[model samples]
Target: MTTKKQKSNSESHERKGVKRFESTTKGSSMIEFISKSETIFLTSLLFVIRLAAATWGIINDCDEVYNYWEPLHLFLHGEGFQTWEYSPIYAIRSYFYIYLHYVPAVIFTHMGLSKITVFTLVRVALGIFCLSGELYAYRAISKNINNTTARLFIFFTMFSSGVFQASSAFVPSSFCMAFVFYILGAYLNENWSFGIFCVAFSTLVGWPFSAILGLAIIIRMVFVKRHILAFIKISFLSGLCIGLTQLIVDSYHFGKPVIAPMNIVLYNVLSGPGPSLYGEEPISFYIKNLIVNWNVAIIASGIGFILSLWPSIGRKNQKGVTEYVSPIVWITATTGLWLLIFWKTTTQRRTIFIPNISIYCIFHCTYL
Candidate 1:
């Protein structure tokens, strides 16, 4: 029963295990091992930079005033302005995710903290949340790609204006970007529970429109595992839990029953004439916007896409090497789809934010 091939294969596996242990002792990556010290330094730098941004980044959007800060102010002081989006008539905005930030603000404020102090605390908290998402992104990318590539994209995310803004701004789009980070990471790692929770939370509480991003992961899981019913069950349960929490909190606040997610879908999509009531432009608008935000990343993504199509084009024979073309191909396709959908449709600046997030995700994923 001890065939020559079997003995050779057993010896090969033993050799690999020994080599891996040797590499571990030598402090060299047999594959990819990023140092804990470097990760800590980068994380600290990200927090400090985002905090600086919070202190300096002026509130630019009126929606940030009405939809987030105002609601938060009301939840604290019992009086704040409202907007059409938060109108009791429409209930397009949910207070559930908003409460996640401001309820703490209220507590701290009640505990003798100044508004300015509590605001800083809130910003720091948001930065930490955003950083958490990026940490997941980093882990996902590092586990699947070259360590150097993972570190480089970490730099990109740490320095990105969009990311800084997202961390500092009090909008659902910005907040959902935080969730987007974890969802992508969980998708790659096949952590179905976390992936479903994040997707559901983002869509149900942060922004219903964000389901667009979640759809990518859902499709992949459903198709790959050939378990459509399982995914549906998970999604339904997650959505029900998140949606019910939002309905309760928002209903109490609005003084009526409110299914905010459904209202959001009705207003933004199913309503007659559509959200074009705000503005619309040719698809070229988002292309121009992306060029402004991420020109270099876009160029690099094109290079990655080309490399993925003909993986052998740039690859060479390397004994004992593990190839990374398949993941790159999938990342290329996902990022391509992200860009096409966000850019080809009617758009706004907040809508454009997803592209920057996608670019970061693709850039890191392709680094494999």
Candidate 2:
């Protein structure tokens, strides 16, 4: 009888302990780092600024006008410039991407809005998408790193000239930049499935090359966290869904089965001429561009990178592997690899590094 009574009490205590732990973890995750009013005020400020950019932002790249807006215009108005890439023979550009903007244009046209107003509204929609990604990243940084770093990230993203340009641009690279914010946020929040989906969606739907940017997260999931099965399962499912949708939509438009993302990747990566056929710039090109857009923040970030190295360089986990250092180290490595690869081409721009600017801001606040 005494043994039975003690066993019952021990089992009940264990159950209560587990429940307490579950509640504490849940409560901590829900705790707001910033007050509600502050969130509202910051959101309003970002939207107003993004709205202004949408209303007045210049089409800095002719590619934006021809490759995206023109194709979208042709889809809606039945007449617009069509680049060689849109040829049925090449089918390099995905009509599915254009289709996303098309639905809104159709709606605005039906509403009797002017072409210019429709244009502004479309850009405004891009701004909202960009803002949501930024805010999510901000929250993730607060939750994963620190609130101060999150605030600094918001400040840099809101005011940077490059962000002002990229936030509303109608280009795959710009779309990739916004998706990257979501990817980073998802990874930091430890939402592995969503992060994997973002990687697949961004690569297949937004920019094919951006799969490289998500490598760190994928690597950590497979090797470090030992979530290889989940990674493969989520990646295959997301890729299948996104890839099939692209094939269906693109095949309908091109008059044959087509995988536009794969085609672009093969052309850009495997072809003899590749992107170099267009033009090439010296390494100085990207440096001057970053200096102009980010100014001293770029230098501060460089210093922060060095500072980050000091703390994480020799760190290792239980397995005694150097690869177990801070996640920032891995992120930094992939980012540097991206720069090395992209700088060799003329097509690379400051806009491609918009998410990196957020990372830089995090480094600046965390280390400096």
Candidate 3:
């Protein structure tokens, strides 16, 4: 019962797949089928780069020191700066995240490491965690997309100054960025359970706003693929488990019942003063920041996003194409939606880091 258009689309995909395989095989040995040894070497090289950033990268925001690192320091040393967000009445920040990082610090400290050395080691752990997510995404990309895009993703992720700035930073946005990598990889690989759990984990344990990035996955499963039963079961189970853990941990830390995620969402989104209490900026603030961090890649992302939309729109009414909208379109459109939401509001550079992770993903979609 396959229609002509469906057959045409299938053949087109097969042709592209063959062309990609031939080009990767013939063009560069580096992008050839990655062997175990090459993966090991790549991991080691990337680890060295990340460790250097953890050791030497300057703190770009006071929030990193005051809001995150200091709370973690207090948990370890019995003293550190306290921010208003940590107050019991507000309780917008979660101690669950702090406790997660604390495990590594305590381990290093037990080894007779100095406090400074422990700090560096803790940051190194963060870098390693972030790197693991990138590696996962790289493998997924190579398997599901093409080796060329995967290679370029690795290069851009390694060399980008923004990665250095945020990779090891002890902040929720940075942590969420790692989760984003896993989410993107899972979406592309169609690992529904892992992807669902990651979205819950990022929203519950890291940043609540990060749930925006999961919209694409939700849409694909619920509306497009129509895995309604599986989606509900997985999302509810993961959300309940992670949310319960976060509630218990954060409530204990604050000496009261506190839903830290909801509290944060209310504060930032519903409160009258909100983030504007600190300051406000023109949309150019993020534009300048993105330009500095990504340079021409930002422009390319915009162009690629615009180009990606055409295919999805064209296929919308095609009866035989199983997926009317490409998953890449879902992803890029969500990122674009995020940009529009934050652009008109009080935008922070740190808040945009999760969305920024999608730039490389979008850039690769252009090749498709």
Candidate 4:
């Protein structure tokens, strides 16, 4: 009787173990499925946002590109690669940007891609690029700080006014922001190959000022290094390689190598008020213009700017990453100073777009 009872109990125990194993396996599969589904949903959502924004910008600003479109059409139809007679006036400034439009023009010509479709594709690409940078920044920050805060910071940054306006309304600036993030990520990881690729691609994207952001990262890395000499050597070599590549491309196309339009704008601002500015204007003029045109963005940014500074006030003994705060502050300050200087000199109110938008994103991220 004892042996039989013991055998029965062993069989019962084995059955329970099997059931548990099956339950664990099922749970694991379910979790995997949910994770994949979530990823798909998020990706689709972002793509849609990008598409919508791009389409809107293209529809509204179609006239902006009309002058360039003729030449673009000619290039697409394989008429000739030589500069069009009208190219000097419209296409002279943003040759790099115009160059990229060639691919979309070709696609449109053959595949029946509408203006809307082309715009959507470009916007989607830009959005993905911008988001990728935010992701990289979040990853880096999370590595050094709490994961939750880092994620929140990234979310704020991505949705900030700077990002939204640049991605949605301004193509060149949006591309610049993406390149900035890419370079930042690569530099932070010390991935020389990836960094160079990012820089080259950014330069190709037609915003040389974007390279300034990259320079900032390189400077930061050098500052943190144990051997300043080695850091300088690497930095110089990298810059040289990038410069040479840019020179080759410029030689092949335009007679002279030129920085992007934003840089030109910056130079104009720095060089005292050009004709764009009616006359010498106070810096307040630019500030007022920003507040008037981008009220929502300005309000959001103002909140963010305040919050970013909040941590510094009355917090002495708080032992944490104070170093992280410096870069954000410096970027904001330098950009703001530059903008204000320009505003004081130039009457061209449009110049406010880049700095205001950029600051808005940075501030929003910091505050949020």
Candidate 5:
């Protein structure tokens, strides 16, 4: 009986020792995971600080464009859904953004909200959008690259001089940047439903041009070959839903099935400067404006463009050249197409935001 009792005591001690060892191992793993996560969080925080500094510098030197003025004015006057003759071009454009501003304006107007309140709210929202977009960009890049490299790319892209200028002067473009980031994140995961929802919400926030996000889906299908069919299907459905909803809203208010009148006028005024110089304006006019407005981005992008083609410069054996080659090709091709098809105007600074950001991502991911 004594021998048997001693044997049972020995077994119990061994079992306790094994359990303690396992617990220690798990504790170490949890600590390591937390440390890594904290590092990522710190990196993102630093990036935001850098971007905010750049943006603040630009805002201090520039005045806000009246982009939000028209919408605010209309809402203040109780015009509700009425169109402005000066910018009637909005009817054919994305109405969602205008409505976003309208909601606040309507509520405030009814409540007799002060001018200071309205302006403060708008500016605060803009700041949040900028920060959120940068965070999203960092997350997207980190998925494919190391955290340090992803943060560096996001920092450079967000704090670039051109981005700073656009964020300060171009209100709509700032919102568009946020939407683009959201779209990229959703696309990276092949989350078509989320992507489409983001695109729609972005379109409402003054990025009517978000209709162009469809191009990204097509590019993904042709190049990445990830969920191509689902992407196409969801994109079409979401677009239809957004369009029909807009039409119904407009028809109910303005007796029209399209956007507001002011938007139309604005488009016509800006759309005059097309890809080629053969139209009404001289080549120098567009060239001069492009250089002046996109000076910093253009210079950085030019360097990236050249670097992307040089295979022997930064060749990595692990991923091969395909990884480097694909992104470079995509950025260059899309940027060139954009310059060729769209009217290059300094006023539309937001046009270059996404492409520039993409270029920055490629540069850091491949070289840095």
Candidate 6:
């Protein structure tokens, strides 16, 4: 009878243990669901905010006129604004980039939308497109850093005027910025090919100078002893495809075979005077711009970088990765270098500096 009692007690304890195991598993799954649902909800809300920003009226540069909206207008209505910049002789501007938006406008127009409505819709579309790039970068940041730091990055990026200004603007820098997102995203996600392709495509089809973003990553990768050979191959193939496609489409428009990228390179770089010939500024131009645009964020980012190099200030991150300085820190540093060197502009310019502000915020929290 004692033996029977012992067996019965042991069976009850085993059943209780099984119940606890099930309860714990259920709780973990619920927590995961809540986390994922919150992320989706927040991302959706952010998307809506960007859409509103697109429809809002903001004065953009004339380049947005001649380079994008104008070309698109002519393509759609058979006549619109034109500027000397698009002259066949120079071929500095791109129809390839314009067509990306033009095709969308075409579809929306076919649905009986007015030109103004179509244009507005397209603007919103472009804004969403740009926002996705930033989101990709956010995901990449989260992967490298803790959830807390990543959340800080998002909060800062959401309110940044520079991001709002650049995201909806129908310009090359704005367009290239999306590719910049993918490049950074792919790099952080460990997709070397997608990252290299973004860099190549942005350089080929958007702004040539945008390739500078890619160069920073390559240096970082080499430093970390990653696959340099694969990056080179991916870059070459992507650049070649983009170049060949651009040549074919542009040749038809210009009425002669023209290498637009080279024309831009020679005109911008090899020319004796450079872009400074048109408009120039003192060193204080950018300093003023940064103060006006991203004052708090930059301070945070500055702190973050300091923390990364010297980690004694904070507890080790949850990942047990003590020295995991985000590759994106280099982006802010490199882009800062670019701005310092080229403070002078051919036109009145506002530095499109959204990413750094986001970076600085994350860095601020990370190190502190």
* Model number with the top TM-score: 3
lDDT of 5 by residue, 232-336 (tens): 777678767766776666555455556542354345456644222233444455566556655555566666666667663445523343343443354334545
State in Å the error of residue 282, model 3.
Answer: 0.1
Put down candidate 1 lDDT per residue, 117-195, tens digits, no spaces.
8887787787788888888877776765556666777777877777877777777877788888888788777688888
- After superposition, the stretches of candidate 1 with alpha carbons farther than 4 Å from their true spots are 1-34, 310-325, 355-361, 364-368
Compared with the true structure, the alpha-carbon lDDT of candidate 6 equals 0.70
lDDT of the structure predicted as candidate 5: 0.53
Worst 10-residue lDDT window, candidate 5: 59-68
The lDDT per prediction is 0.73, 0.82, 0.81, 0.53, 0.53, 0.70
| C-alpha positional error of residue 149 in candidate 2 after TM-score superposition, expressed in Å | 0.4
| lDDT (Cα, tens digit) per residue for candidate 3, span 103-220 | 9898898899999999899889989998998899888877766677787888878887767767898988888888888888898888999999999999888888788889988998
The residue pairs found clashing in candidate 2 are none
How many clashes in each structure? 0, 0, 0, 1, 18, 2
Which scores higher on lDDT, 1 or 3? Answer: 3
Q: Which stretches of candidate 6 lie above 4 Å from their native place? A: 1-34, 311-328, 344-348, 352-368
Using TM-score as the measure, name the better of candidate 2 and candidate 4: 2
TM-score of each: 0.85, 0.86, 0.87, 0.62, 0.63, 0.82
Give lDDT tens digits, candidate 6, residues 1-368: 56988999999999999989978976765454347776797679778777877888584687777667888999998998777667897787777777778888999988999977897888789878877877777777666544565666677667767667767778777777667767766766767778788877888887787766676578666665366787678778988898989988888888888777777778878875656566666667667777667666556656656656544433444445443454545655565565654664523445444333333344444544
lDDT, candidate 1, residue 148? Answer: 64
Clashing pairs in 1: none
lDDT of 3: 0.81
The TM-score of predicted model 4 comes to 0.62
Q: Rank candidates by lDDT, best first.
A: 2, 3, 1, 6, 5, 4
Clashes of 6: 2
Candidate 4 stretches greater than 4 Å from native: 1-41, 58-71, 78-94, 104-108, 112-116, 150-162, 168-171, 184-205, 210-215, 226-242, 255-282, 288-334, 347-352, 355-359
